[model samples]
Each structure stands twice: as structure tokens, then as C-alpha cells.
Target: MRASVELPATLPESLRVQLGQVLPNDPNLRRPASEAAGDGVLVRLGGHADYTTVTQKAALRACLRMPSGATLLIRMATGSGKSLIFQTATRWWREVSRDSLKPVSIVLVPTISLALDHERSSQAISGLETVRALTGDHSSEERNRVLLDFRQGNVPLLFVSPEMALGSLRESLRELSLPDQHPARPNAVRGKLAAVFIDEAHIVATWGRSFRPDLQRIPGLLRSLRAIDPEIRTVLLSATVDAETRELLRTGYVDRDGRWLEVAECMPRYEFDFVEHRFTDSISRDDEVLVLADVLPRPALLYTTEVEHAERLHQGLRRRGFERVRLFTGDTEPSERRRIVDDWRDGRVDLVIATSAFGMGIDQGDVRVVVHACLPESASRYYQEIGRAGRDGRQAFAVLCAAPDDFKLASRMAVGSTLTLDVAVERWLALLEGARRTEDDDPWSGMPQYRLDLRARGRHIANPRVGERNRVWNKSLLVQLQRYGALEIASSDDDSDGWVAVPRAGNDGLWDATTCKSFLTQIFGARAAEEERAREGIQAFKSAWRVRNDCRLRMIYHIVEAGAPELSACGRCAGCRRQQVAPPHHVATGGGGESLWPDSLSPPSATRLLELTETELARPVRWLDWLRGRGVEQIVVERRLASEIAALWSKVERDAGWVISWDLVETRSFRPMNVPTALVLSEKSGTELERLWRWGKRWNDRTHQVAWWVALRGTQIGTRSLQDEGAAGIQPPAHLPSEE
Candidate 1:
């Protein structure tokens, strides 16, 4: 039986030995058919035999039933079918709304390669042939064609970079919210925009500050979209989202009065066998790379921190008779980059010497090795990049070669683009002056808006050739202010000369020195602390790679999965090999958990919810108006009803000043609310009613002067009645009543 076990011929001999001991004796360890059944949407979209993990099923169900203004963050492991969630949702929407209004979705990617990759893969999926990637690489004709199709409701899945999203696609996106008349039939509605997906979402927090400020502007785009259609949903997808990134996303994307659901399977990849090496100098590292190039597995990726290094390595490997090696970097031309990706995927290229520009969302599954020639800037980046390997569920290897200078380079890269407080203030003042000259106030919000010049120079700057640098700093300042809720950037033009923005209400005094100073200090201080944390993370990674006594994979996982329980030592790692520990017979690869929603209680279809009659909608609208008239500042409802009510309330009140929270009886933290707020509890569960009762008593004890009110969903709370307390009984909408 052992001799008969078959493995892929492409796998390396060493990996073969490691995997040989782990091959299960029962070759057919598949789950029973009954246990492997999938959701109807998944089965229809994927196949009858398709099996999905619990996390994927839950996320898909949520997506299908996602309410307006809600944000869903999915942090699943690489190769875990994260893309399936959005694909299924998009197709499901198309199927359900084919005869009515067809809805479209936009997928924002970090790089052009990723956009093109998605577009190519989407062509094979059913009901997604209209998918198109609109990027600068396309000719004007191609872009116009894509735009025409999008405007006609022909394009269903559109892929674009952040730049295109802010530039040419801005108007088209906004037009999605406006009702369109059908060309063929009178009084017929055409299409509506349903969702926006941000792929590789971690970049919004990590790279948006400096490298691509447009990523940070995405929330502003969503704000504009929601202003028109309050029911549009936003989905953020990534393989890793650290605490800082998660917090940034919450502040930027999640609506204050809406619901936030995070679906995460925070576990390290167990398929990788890690190997670490430290060199005394570049000369030694180069020689070592040459030696390993011959012995390392084929279809490998060698990463460098800079373009020059990648070019040099490519040349050296080619000179040493490696004919199938290629170079890819930021400077690579658009056509060549596409060609490289194609060749790499088609097995024409055996090795790729590249910077961070390549291999994001690339779906080559048989890659066996990922060699890092230099230290990455952060642990998240390191993990994301190395995840390019072992995607086929086979054994793979991660080789790290670091030098002393690499650490310095990584530290410098981490803290290079942050601005000082004084400089930020100067830049802001200069931009504000330019905006005053433009005098472009927004018509909708009635706030003073402007198209501030990105190239504006401060009085202290004498150099005339630093316009580009000035533009970067100006955009960075604007992004920081926007993230802090000081302003909103409405849009930008293709020339990239300026961005239209307006001061958020109550922040109109941002031009005042005292107020400006206070705000800038908070932004700068938080940025400084973030930089410090990044530096510490870099140091920790360096320390982990330097120490050879411990399992490198475990140390790396600890850094990336902060506060996670210690994982079992990988038996194939260097430390385990030194200790001669036997490899495990099998390893679990995908996420594991029960479905968030049971089959019997599946959520109502988005179509059904959106089709509420005027009378049905008016009931919730009237309830919200009454609450507003009563000066209710805080609204507490069960998790199920919060989203529906919040959507209704947003339509009536645009400011979102009221705070909406869940009544799940869990310990949670909240931002301080200082207004003369009225708390309205709309709960039906007995346990939650008791919890709110205890909460109201504590609130009265703390604030003796403030008055609070209770709004019960029903008259009875378990065995007790609230009729004597003068509390009002507010029933939920007739269409969506409390599930007592």
C-alpha cells in the first residue's frame, strides 16, 4: 500500500519524503454525501458535488441577505475560496432580478495585475461573461466600450484599480444610484448598483497613507453612493487583517448607525515548511542564491525589496544558464507585466524575480517555493507574499535569506512617508487657500467644497522643482484629515491635478489655528504611534528570523496572529527536523465552524426585503420619526432588527447622529456619548430584557440628571409587564416583526 501511493511528479524529492509519511492509509477519506451537501446558491453556482467550508457558507448567506449601509469584513486564509462569496452573491443577484432591475457590482483591486487576473478568471464563471477590467493599460476605445456596457447594464462584475475608481469611473458609479429608463420599453426601470467589493483590502490601511492615497478615498466614494442609494452594501476581503487595519476599516467604512459583521478564520497556513538564513553581506547572499537556484523547486518566486535588486538577480540567474527566469518590478511596462503573468501561469516561466508588485490574487496553484531574497517591510506583507505558495494543498517551502542591512531597509521603508504635525498644518493651509480661490462648494451637502490644487506650495518652500513631492504630501494630508472625519473628498479628474472635497459639518472651523492645531496633533500623534508599532513589528520579525533554536513558522505565526493560542510545531520546519520529530499523518487546511444561520432560519432574500410596499415602509419610517421627535439619541435593538431599522432611519436622517447598538448582552466598548441622549431599548428576549434593565439602572445611577426611555417590542418581557413604567410599546414593521 505504501509503495502504491501516488504523488505528483513535479514535487521535489525532499517534499516527497516528507509527504510520504503523511499520506493517509484510507485513500478515500471523503466526507459522506449527506454531510458534504452545500447551500443551494453554492450548489447551483459551483456544482452539485461542490463542498464549501462553514465560513464560506455563512459569509455567502450574509452577502445574499446584506442590508443597505452594512459592511462585511471577511478574513479567511489564502486559497480558502474567499472569492466565492462575492461571485455567488453577484450571480445570485443577477438570477433573482433578471426580469426586474439588474444590479451591478464593482471590485476594487490594489494592482492592475489583480484586476486583469479577476477579469480573466470571471470569463469562465457562468453569468459573469460581461466582466471587464477598466484600467489605464486599456486603450481609450476599450475603456469607452466597457463604460458603454456598464451604462447599459450589460456589465455585471467590473474590476478596477483605485485610481480608475476615482478618475474615469466616478460618474458611471454615481449613475448607478439614479433610476434609468429602459430604452426598449416605456416606464421600465433598467438597473441599480448593489454592492462594492474591495479586494486585498488591507492595502487601504497600509499603503493608502502614502503609496496610493486613492485607496483611502474609497470610503468617501461609498459615502457618496449611499447618499443616493442608502441600501448599497460594501464588502471588504483579504487574507489577513491585523488589529490596526481592522480598526482603521471600522472607522473609515462601517456606518455609525449600521451593522458590522466580521467573519474571520484567524489561523496560520500549515502547508508551509519554513527555512531561514542570515548572511553577513550581500556578496554571500548572492552566491548562496546562485547555489540554491539549481536545487530549489521549480515554479518559484524570488522576492526583492527594490527594482534594481530584482533586475540584478534576474541577470545573474540568466547568465548562469537559467533560461526560463524572468524579472518583474514596478518599472515593468504594462504589456510586459501582463505577458509575464500569462507566461508564469502557463508554465513557460520557471522563476520570477519580482518586487511586491506581482503575485497578488494570482491563481497559479502548483507553486512549490517562495524565496525571499530580502526582509519584507512588515509581518503582514511577509505573510501575504509567502502565501503565494502551496495553494494546491501540497507541501511547499518558504526560504528566507536576510542580511543586517535588510533590517535597516525594512525599518526605513516602514516609516518613510509619515509627515510631521507642523508640515501637515502648513500643507493644509496652502491647500485650503487654493480651494478658496477655486470656490467649488458642493450643491447637495450645502458645504463649502473645493478642488484644491495638489501642486500647491507653502510659503516656506523655495524649490520650484518639487511639485511632485508637494502633490504627494498634499494628498497625504487630505487623506489623513478625511480619515479623522474632518472632510470628505467627493471626486477627482483624470489629470490628477486636484480633488473635490468639503468640510464635514461641525468641522468647518478646521481652518482656525487653535482647532486645526488640536486636530492635527491628534492625527500626527496617532500616526507616530502607528509608525512606532510598525517599527516594533519589524524588529520582532528580525528577531524571530535570527533565532534558529525555535520553530520559525511558529514564531512568525505568533507575530501575525497576535494573542492567538500557540499552534503545534510544524514537524517539517528546521527546528523540528533538527529534533527529528515525526511528521503528522494529516493536516487540516480549510476553516472549520458551524453555519452562522441554520438552514431552517435562513435569512430572507435581498429581493424580497427590498420589495417592501410603501405602506410597509411607512410604518418603520413613522416609528423612526416619532423617535426623532421624542429626541431619542441612542437606539438599542436586537441584532436581527438593527440593520432593517437603521436602513430606514438613514433614509429619513442623513447625518447619522444617532448611535445604534446591539442588545446581545455581551460586554462591549463604545465611544463616549455626551449629548442629552435618550436610550430606547427595543428588545423581546427575556435574557436581553434583563440585561437592558440592569444597564438602565446602572445608567441612572451614573447620570442622575439625564432622562432615559424604554421602547419595548412587546408588552411582556418573560413573565413581567412594563405597563406601569410609562414605557411606550413600539412594534416592529409588519413585514419584519421580532422573532419571539
Candidate 2:
């Protein structure tokens, strides 16, 4: 009784008909109720208003049939209420399987971030029972208590991160039997293994391919679960995934002969808008920074290429006096992450300058923008990140800062964790039957590699020609040969060349003979095609990066169109032509001329300032150039920014004497330079504006202008109270709600 068995009734005919429009397939209806004397139970697929949408309902019904073998994908983007769906599905399972012998559900999220978010969300949706989480980071005693509760069906919803699930399951099995025997259990080694939901399922391929070595052993784990219980239901969920990912799920999980499961596909809402901009040389770099600032100022995100840049930009913005900027990166402490999440949800921070480590699953319903300081290695990642925006169904922007070097960097990462074909073959072959053997050389059990070499040496690949290419190919061949059992040649003359695997003492009758053969043929044969597809999948991602810049849009468009769009857009995208590009210095209308940071430097933004230079803009420019030991130095010596960055400074200035030109710079000469600003927002008539110098909406500085306008209607309030007379009918600070 190791496995949890859930006996759910099939979808009703009328419900099935309605669900058919949205859910995939008619669904596996329950067999007639058992011939018990008691009354039979009735169940409905999805009872939500939005489930009326085909994809939403389909995905829900499919969840009940977890362990579907194929990876299940749910692409609702960010803020689409994925937590809502999980909540509803879990509740539905509870209702449908309560009377059954086994508890019906277990949810496995990918990261602690998602776990925390899900835990709170589940409670908001249903409070029938307390929903608890089990994390390895918890104390041993705490973990034991949680596990005890889960094993006994004391908790209806058990939310856990993937790492926690793996460790917990392993520990549970260890307590039941030895490590090796764990997988051979009758069911998941527990009588309550009803359903398991794997959140962020894409990690099974992405991150799982790297640091999480245990992920590669997941298929085996799943097998063990089934061995313990045949009726265990497993669900895989991801808000964003690609066709390659979908295929990988199919071959690696579902299509395995060890498990006979079905699959259901759900579509995504709207084709995503993907674009990139250069970061260095020319105004593109400035444009990108401004774009991010503009987009983020409207409850958006600002991204940076590196930690140094993040720190620098964060400091710079604070000094420029933007009190609403929040910085988040890998370096941010967990306590800080929680705080940042709170601010975003509460609307305190207008934007977060974060690294990729930010926002895996912190749901902020009104994210209006996602700015990438660097281009992501793949569009899959791009899609996932951009999903954070428009959670409330408002328009949003996804901007990529694609400098010349940015592409190369992203390209480098594209091949980052990829394994060469040779390496792949060798690793797989090394894990073959013979190589998995115990060594006789040692008294105690251990693996033997010499026998594998001997068998490989006799193969055709052992006889190689010349050239590096051939050498690589030969290595691949050796790897391929190990697919089957080997080691016919025993070191001693008396033994046969190949040795058969020694079965466990009592496992002689483990699997039915015919059943074993069928599984073997099905798995090995199907795996061949899967391997080929994986190779191609990797190749396609690599090729997309090489596409010409002009043609790059097509690759993006192709991916967007290929994924079914289930949600309609609210326009305002480059695709939707909401804004037009302006002439140089003329500014772009799509996003107010990217100057979001020039208004006023906040305290943190000025950390680099040495007494805040007050110099003739031209002389300071020359000194700056001199320091760069580059062209800017000569200009500084000759004097250039004298009129710009110089004027913005107050005296006590470093190199020269200058006046605080808040008003002067606001009215005169200008150029794009990276600066941070503390935007004090206001409304004039119908337009929302930020006082760059304490007053007026200057469209000349794009990012700020864009940021001001977008955030206005969204119900935003400035950090400080200003004269109410500046704008007609603008709410006074008293009427303004605090920015979250």
C-alpha cells in the first residue's frame, strides 16, 4: 500500500460537452459508480467563470489526470491568476476524491519564492483546511512533523518547492526501506500519493539540466512512485515553455513505456512582443536605459547586465532623487526579497532594478513594464520574464537592451550548459548496464570501469583513423556501444567474455518476464527519436541567435505566432503601433524620450558623487575624458558637458565651480547621459507629469515623460507633497495614496 490511489468519477456528459470546447479531448469519464448501496457522487469539470475560456478549462480537467507522462504546460503569462487555477484544481480534486481511500493532491512548486506565493494564494482561494509547506531549510523536527502530517492525510494541500519534494520523498522512502529499495515500493511508498503537481515544470529541462543533478533521476523516481501505487496522479505546470520543451516533456516523461499516460495542450494569451536595443555606442544605449526607466516608472522593472551596473545604476537613480526605485538581484538578501515583494504588491516601489534572480513567481498584478538591461540567451526566457507585466489586463511593455556586445554575451550563454555530442554519448554510455556493475577487484561492492573499456576496445570504434573530427566521432561510437549490456571478456581465462547483471537476491521474479521486455523495447526504441529531436532542439535555439538583426524580428514573430494566443491584447505594443519613432534628438513617442533619470538624484543615486561637482560643465567634461583617457577626456580638456551634467550640479562641486542648474538645464542644452532621478509625480489636466526641476512635464527627456504618463492613470501618488497650484485639478498630497 505504498502508492496513493485516487478513484475519481469521470466527467459528466453535460459537463463534458461544455468542457470539450475548452478542455482538450472529451476527457476520461469516470466508469459507472461502484455497485454500492449508497448514493453515487457527481462532479463538474471547471466551475470558474473564466474557465469558460477553452485553454483554462482544458488545463484544469487535464490536471486531475496527472502523471500524464507528457510534461503539462500552462502558459498564462504572469498575473494571469495561475495561482487561481492551481487553487481551483486542488479544490476540485479534494471534492472529487474525499470519499476515496487516498487523499487527492500534492503541489510541488519550483522555488521557495513560488511556494510562499502559492501558500498565501491557496489560502485566499480556499480555507477549508490549513495549507502547509515542507522545505529542507526547515529544522529536522519540523520536517518530520510535516511529513508525518502529509503521510497521514492530515493536510488537504501540501505545497512544496521541487527541491523540498525530492528531499522529503527520499527521506520518506529511506524511513520505509533502504535507499535502493525505495523505488521498488508498491506505490509512492505512501498510501496517500493521490496527486503531485510540479510547478515551473520547465525547470525539469532548464535548471534541472545543470546544478540539480537529482532532476535527471526524476524519471526513476516517478517509476518508484508508481511501483508503490499504480494510481498516483502527477501534474506538470509551467506558465511559459517552447515547442522543444513540449517535445522534451513528451519523450522524457509521458511517452515512456514504463508509464501509460495521456496529454492535454493549453494555448497562451496574445502573441508576446519581443524587441532588443543596443547598450553601448550611440544613443541606443541611452535609449535602452531610458526605455527601462520609462517603462518601469509606470510600475515596471529595470534590469542591468551585471551587479556593478545594478549597483551603479541603483545609486545613480537614488541620487537623481527617485525615491521609488527598488533594486533586486542575486545578491539581495532573502529578507530584502520579501520586503521588495511587499512594496511591489503594496505599490510602494515604482520599479525594481533587479537581476534574473528576481520575480520567479512573485505575482504583481499591475506590472506595466519589464526592461532587460541585457538580452536573454533565448526567447523562452524572454517570454517568461515579460509575462510579469500586464497582470491586470492593462497594456505593458517588454524591452531588451541589445547592445553590440549584448548579443555576443547572450550567444555565449546560449551554449553555456550545452553538452557537446561527444560528452553526451560518453555520459550515457558510462551509465550502461556493464558500467553500472559492482567491481570484483574490491571485497566490498563498487563500480568497475576496466571491464567496460575492454568491451569497448573490441568494438569497431576502438580501431580509429586520424584527424580531430574522427577522434571525436570515435568517442561518440564508444558511448553508443555501451547502450547495451557488455563485458563478455572476464579478466580471468575461465570466465566468459561478457558477464550478465547480478540481480538482487530476491528480485528474480521482480517484473513479469513479458512485461519487462515490452517496457524495454518501448523505452529504448522511443528514446532514439527523442535524442535526435533534442539535438535539433538545441540547434534551433543556437541558430536563432545568428539570424541577421533585420531578420531577427521574423524569428521572434515566428515563435509568437507558433504559440496559440488565447488572450487578446489591449494594443500599445510596437506590433500594435502605439507610438512612433522620432528623429535623432527629436525623441521617440512610443516611450517619452528616454530621459527618466535626469530629474533629481536621490541619496543612494549620488554615492559616487564627490561633493557633487560644481564646475563649468565644459571643464568637468574635459577632466572626465582625461580620466577615461579617451575622447571624452579631450572634450573635457577642451570642455563639452560643461552645459549639461555640469549645470545639474550644485557647487562644492569637485573639479570646478558651477551653479545648481536645475532650472537652467531644464530649459537649455541637453544630451543623453545615464543619471538617476527621484521623480515627484503630479497631474496637469488629464496628463500625468513628473517635475524634472520641480515643475513641468518635459517630453524632451523621453523615459521620464513616458514613466510619468503611464503611471498617472494607474492610481499612483508621489513621495513628497508639493504646491497644489502647479496643476489644475491635480490631487493634493493629502488626496494622493502612498505609492507602494
Candidate 3:
């Protein structure tokens, strides 16, 4: 029998059906590709034995057929061949256009680590030595040679960070491909540049606000590149992008003239289960580590929100006898980063504790577990990190251990100002004014310098700790300041502790103090609003996380794809399994429990009513289970009727804080605010039904919203009639009701 066939009965019935449909006896969910088109390339990826997912095949085929000047976004699940999509697409593009030598693809990544990871993967393939990465680490001579080759159009696939691409690369490419110097290298600039791929595309949205200011230059750079290759294709890829983020990418990156295609395929084969445990103030890191040691499988990954935590956790695990564990973070030397990653992939290291820096662009199969030592900044990050496990069509676990304060801390981190925005504005204006005061400070004498003690300034503005400005915020403000054309930054080197820059007397309409102030106000104001909204969203997400009792997988799904069709519980999660093992002690029994509550009671507060109606209504099944488990005997309610109650609950909650529970309803009491509890009435005796109807009518008459009703057999849950009063209790109020 298949593993899915034995799904625990505790899972909601609807989810069980969906899981059964998708999860078959064969756990490997690869759909066989029609052996046409890119099958040749597929056979050569890693070897003929390399398994390609259906999504990869589809993406490859689409890339092959993508028209010139088109834009494509591939949002495949993490660890599900996102890099392969670009790799295969690049190869296929090269194969089809084998005739031209001019640069065909320019891949833009966010970090040097990602660029290296891509280069290594590409070099493994026989024909992909042409796949090279351009970075500052390359010697000037080597960089010149690569650029010269690229100008002469020899390099086919090149990977580069945004910094190199927008800075030195653009400068060198312009110098090499000077229209006057084209005859100097006829073989170089032959064919037009074909496509530009942006891997880890989510960064364009997430980091565009601050971390990597150069990312914001991508759109403008692409526009300039279009002048060279009018038909150049653009591809953006990421493992985690919510609908809101995807829309942002379109508006911010993909220009209006470009044709857009989206390739999204759900992750299959892997059965992901999530378990969360809370640590209290009394629990130590050692205690948390021990709990993990007991439950975690070999080849696990532990994620921390900060690098220092990663360091401490790594040491703690080793002390607890998990010596196979190692650490990977931005602090690790480049050479060490490579070694640790290679060792982890080879099973030489059983585990690695790292921050967000480690996961992207690396794929390790057979990972059995992933643990989040701290709560992630957002559900998107949480989901992507967990995706690392279960890539090999096997069952895996993702455990998140959080303390009470973790949510607020994460929220503050998510929304907190990296630097004092007002201080940054002040500094930029002061520096520019200083430059203006220098009589001989020829605007053309090249970029000026700002000997800023950012560390000191960071402390002065917000009393920020050491490394806060570098790690958290304010670096991007310089970039924005430069864009205002007042202070043009030449370079930011660690040796200087500040940045070298020039004051631009705006060749594009001279920068004056007034214009600079206007730009600063507008830019800073927008950033302030963005931070405000992000904080609100983070807080809401934290609230949702605590209240979530259904499938952890489903919660992630909803967060990622809001308004996505409801998915049933995965029956494999800790919650589902708990319900299955612990049989109820006192289920609502079938006979005369109608007049169970006293007649005289105070009306419920608006908050209590809304809580019972709206807050509890979102999950109809849970509420039904709650009713059944509680001592409400002979209860009867339809799913649709329950949903209406839930919708009404929202309105009530908005007007009044909501509350719902048997204890609260009876003790705190509300005459006109009762939320009817639901129960299955199909198998009930006629006498039982009569008793429930009599009780329900009494409850309905007293409340503004009607009480429960027997859901008729053959009637759909959401489409049941409210007029069927003869069958059960008084008809429930619809979200929009009239005199019916």
C-alpha cells in the first residue's frame, strides 16, 4: 500500500480527497515529457540519468519558444529545479543560436556567492565553460580579457552580481564596444545579446528598498541593453514570491512594452510536515538544542535569523554531541563557504546552521529535516527555507521553535529603520552643501568624498549597536542620494569607513539645494510608508501564526497564495496526528441536551459575539469539530450556514472585539450574539432531530443571528437554503439577507 493510502483519519475529509488524488503509489511525481524538443538537452544535464521534473521540462520548452524581447517569470517551488530552468533555458538558447558568438545571455545575481554557485554548476556541464561569472574578485587583467571577449561577442553565458553589472561592467562594455571602435574588433560584437536572466528574482522586490541599491538599476540597465539587442529576452526567477511581490516585480522590473509569461507549477511528490514548539523564558538554548536532537533526522538544516545565533547554535549542537554540524553564514570566508557547502552536499557534514545567506542557488538532495531556530521575518522566508528539505520525493519535516517574544522581535526587525532616515538626509545635505562651498570644487573634478564615520553616526542617530548600519540599513540611502544628482558616490570601501563621492552640478538639469531637498523628502517619505505597511503585515502574520491549528502546510500555502482554493489538512502534521491519537473524552451526545443552558443570562459583549461568529468561522471544519467535541448535545448546522455566521462575525469583530467559546458563551453570556455551533445530523433519529430543532429555534429567536440547522443529505455545504426551517432550527442570516 502507498504511504498516502494510510493518511490518518483526523485530516479534514476534503483534504484527504485532494491528497489522495495528487499523491499516487509512485512517489516520484515526474511527468514524462513528450520526447520532442529539448529532450537532447535534458539527456545531457548532469548525465542521461539526471531526473528532470515536469516543471523543468515545461519551463525549458517555454524558454525555447519565447519570442525575442519577451519577459518570463518562473516561480517553481524551491528545490524544484529553479536554477535548472535557467541553466536549461540558457543552454537551449545557445544551442538554437549556435551560429552567433556575440554574448547571448547576461545573468544577474544578487551576491558573489550566488554568482560562484552558478558558475560552478555551469562548469560541470561539458559545453558550459562558456558559462562564466564576472565579479570584483577577478583580477583586473582577467576582467578586461573577459569583457574584451564579451565585447567581441565571444562569451555566450555570463553570470554577474548587480554591482559589477551596473558599475565597472557597464563602463568597460561602453569603452570596448565604442561605435568608433567596432571595426577594431569585428569578431567581438557580432550577434545581438539574446537574453538576460535574473535569478533569485525575489531580491528585486525584497532588497530593492535598501540592501542592494544596485538592484533598482536593473530596469534602467535592461532598457539601455534593449538599444543593443532590440529583441533581447528577460527572465526573472525565484523560489518564493507572494502574489503582491510578483505584481511589484512586474511594475518595477518588466517594462510595459515587454511580453510577459509566467510559469508556475506546484511542488509534488514531497510530503512536507511542519511541527512547532514554543520555548519559554525559562528554557535555554541548550534545552532547545536537546529537544531538536531528540526529534531531528540526520542530514538536517537549522536556520537562524542572525549570524551570531547560528554560531552559538552550531557550538551548542556540538557540545550536545552533534559534532557533525557546522556553520554557514555571510561571515564565513569565501573559500570556507565553498568548502562547507561542498562538504554538506557530500554528507561529510550532517548539518549546517546558517542565516538567509546560505540556501539560495544550492541544492542538496536527501535532506530529511529543517529546523527554524527563530521565527522568520515573514511567512515567505519561512516557506522557502523549509522547501530545502524533501526535495528527493521523500517525507521530511520542518520544525519551527519560537519563544513568546520572537514574533515581536521579528516584526521590529522587519519594519524597524535600518538607519535614522532623518539623519541620513541631514548628512547628505550637509556633505553636498560643503562641496558647494568649495570654490575650486570643480563639478567636473570627479566624484567628491564623504569621510563619514557611519558607525559613530549610526550610534548618534539611533544608538544603534556596532555593525547595525552595515548589516541593517542606511547604505541604500547613499544610493538614493546619488540618484538625486546632488551627491554622486564613487565607491564604498571598508578601508575608508565611509564613501568617496562627487557632487554633481546636474548635467541633467543642475542639482540645487531646493531640488535635492525635494528629492530627499519624496524618497524618504515613500520609504517611511513602505516600512509602516510592512510592520502591520508582519504583526498580522504573527497573529495568524499563533491561531493556526490546521495543517502547517496549508497555512504556508494560504500565506503564499492568498485566496487560493482551500486545501485539506495533510493528515501528516503534528496537529493532525495529535487529533488522530487522542480520542475525544466527551463528544456532544445525541439526546435531550436542548435546555442545557439557563434561561436568564446577560447579553454577550460585541467582542465575544464577533469572536464566536467571525474569528471562529474561517475554518468551518474546526468549528464543527469544536462543537462536536464540546458538550453541546444534538447540535445541527450546515457548512454554508456556518460560513454565513463566520462572515457576519467579521463585521461584528470590526465593530467589537470578538470572543467565542462554550465557557464564555455560558458564563459571560449574550442573548442576541450567540454563534450557532454545527453538528452532523444525517444519522440522527427523528426524535433527536425534533429535540435539536426545538432547542435551535429557541436559541435562534433570542439571537440576532439564527441558530443551527440540519444540513440535508445531497445538499452542497455552501448552497443550502435558509428557508428550510421545517427541517431544523430557524434559518441562519445570510451575509446579505432580505425579507425572505
Considering every candidate listed, which one attains the maximal TM-score? 1
Error of 1 at 94 (Å): 1.1
| Most lDDT-accurate candidate | 1
Root-mean-square deviation of Cα positions for candidate 3 versus the true structure, in angstroms: 20.4
lDDT of each: 0.67, 0.42, 0.54
lDDT of 1 by residue, 377-475 (tens): 888789889899877666666888777788889998876676788888887778777774245555546777678888888887899898887787787
- Rank by TM-score (best first): 1, 3, 2
TM-scores, all candidates, are 0.73, 0.52, 0.61
lDDT per residue as tens, model 2, 1-740:
01222211242233223222222211221111111010001012222222222233334434433343333445444443455455655555555553433353567765555665666656654332466766545677877777676555556577775545445455453233222245444443342455556666666655554434344434434444544444555566666556656555554444233443322222332322334433345244643364235323267777654676677767766766778888877677656766677677678988788766667777876676677767665566665677777555434556655556666665555443433444434433432424434454321112232333224222324444433444333333332222222111112111223322222223223123333334334434544554555445444544554453223333443453234433323232333222332112211111111112223322221111111112322234433322223111001101122233333221111212111122223433222222222222223222223445223234313423211111122232354323332253222322122227
Alpha-carbon lDDT of model 2: 0.42
Runs in model 3 deviating more than 4 A are: 1-54, 98-100, 111-113, 134-155, 172-192, 266-270, 416-475, 478-525, 562-565, 578-740
Worst 10 residues of 1 by lDDT: 602-611
Kindly give the stretch of ten consecutive residues in candidate 3 with the minimal lDDT sum. Answer: 587-596
* Residues 1-740, model 3: lDDT tens digits: 23444544543354344345433433432222211112334544323322233345446545655667777777665666667666655655655554535435778987666777777777777667766787655778988888777666566568888767776776543333334345544544653466779998877755665555667656646655554445678888876567667776675455446467666553322356556656664145335555555445668888888787788777777777877777888788766776776787668988888888776766776777788878887776777778778776566667777776677778766764444656665655544454322222323343333443444343345544556544224446665554433454444443334544445544322245456555666656766766876776676556555663445566666666423454555665555554553322221111111111222333422111111333334344444434334322222233234223333332321111111222212322211223333333332235445444444445555652332333343322233333433344333322211215
Model 2: lowest-lDDT 10 consecutive positions: 33-42
